[model samples]
Target: MAGCTGATSERTAAAVHGLPEDALLDMGDFAGAVLKYLRRHPVDRLTIAGGFAKLSKLAAGHLDLHSGRSQVDPRHLAALAREAGAGEDLAGAVAAAGTGLEALRLCAAGGVALGDRVAEAARATALGVLRGAPVTVDVLCVDRAGVVVGRAAPAGPPERGTAGGAARQD
Candidate 1:
């Protein structure tokens, strides 16, 4: 014979289901209400500035671009750079990537050591532009907070600082 279910258990399950259903229910305009609440509550906001170059540290070890004859992996490059203290320029470059996640990926791929390597790579490309190598590369510079301070393509002229410093003649 089949066992009969108890009404108490059925009621309990129904009650449990009703409580969590709120998550599934759509709360139209709830975000506006929350924003209003926060506005009234007065929470402090912090501004963080960083570039794609630094954030790329997260994935720097995975990149294998421009490797030939036992090329250093991105992670190895990053680790080495970390040991050698090569974060700043790379971070600046990553910050210059125009987006947060892209910067992070570059950081991860270039690794710490790879930061200098990438910067070197960028410098080499810049130098090639100087030498009329005919290869096109874009150079971007950012401050420590990841804010883009400069961008230059191999074919374009250098940018001027906010105070109108003399433009780089090269």
Candidate 2:
């Protein structure tokens, strides 16, 4: 279900950027919201920034991050962990973790960049969702403390801090 936190973040971002409150949107559907907004607005660069759990879902190719529509699949994450060169034990732990954040923590402790992999996967997924919409999409996973735990920068004109690269700072 939608909550006040997302609305509050959107409003805060809009206010801080001096844009209209509606400029930054969160209707609980990430891909739907972007697609709907794109229908009326001309956007070149899009940044998908939010919690790690939903970002993990995005990495797993879920267009909708709502609890009703999708969930963070630990098995998919375990596969990503394996792709990141994590051992089977770690992958098993990730699959057993209660949340995406826990899986990330396990990867971090094991010197694996699971978040980076997840971010890149999420970026690719977002690009696929856009389907040649001429938008450069970046996926960033930030924790509650305002730390950029992971990021996937798309190839595009450099603006703000977006450069083509995978970021992992656990």
Candidate 3:
């Protein structure tokens, strides 16, 4: 697992899961970091742990996963909320939410698993990178307090999005 403790990290999850992390999961390039770790150590499965901001970039298929390189577009998040069964009002709230975590909370309060959707999207992106490498990927969306708010196991969704038109570069 990888993700925080510092401002750009949620290393609590990494510590809990016992991942050897040496860089910030946010700006170090999340997918790149995972692949780099794989090149050395061997692991059967992979877990990506982070909050909404980090995961949102992954969900949007941003390999860089940095604020400057890729940003969390509330409109895309709102669309995901709608796809997750959030009503118009709640979706609008997500669009205007102050922070990514706040938007996630709004979706959760409205009984929508926005983070799950995001995790699944991120997993799909990772699988694309893996390219049938026989490794399964799981993504966890953790809140700042180190609570697991959402998850997407490899066996969960068949595929959330592809490395195609579904992913938004912006």
The TM-score leader among the candidates is 2
Give a tens-digit lDDT track for model 3, residues 1-170: 44331342356556556666553354345565564455355356666766667778777777667677778878878988898899999999999987888899898888999989887777776655555444556777777676777787653223433232233333
Q: Please give the CA lDDT of all the candidate structures.
A: 0.31, 0.66, 0.67
- Candidate 1 per-residue lDDT, tens place, 55-157, comes to 1221232121222312223443334344445576774564355544454356556644333334333333223223322222232334443334333322311
Candidate 1 ranges with C-alpha deviation above 4 Å:
1-73, 76-117, 129-138, 142-146, 149-170
Q: Write down the TM-score of every candidate.
A: 0.21, 0.74, 0.73
Worst 10 residues of 3 by lDDT: 156-165
Q: Clashing residue pairs, candidate 2? A: none
Give the TM-score comparing model 2 with the true structure, all chains together.
0.74
Clashing pairs in 3: 3-10, 4-9, 4-10, 4-11, 5-11
Superposed by TM-score, candidate 2 places the C-alpha of residue 5 at a distance from the truth, in angstroms, of 8.6
Q: What does the lDDT read for residue 142 in candidate 3?
A: 75
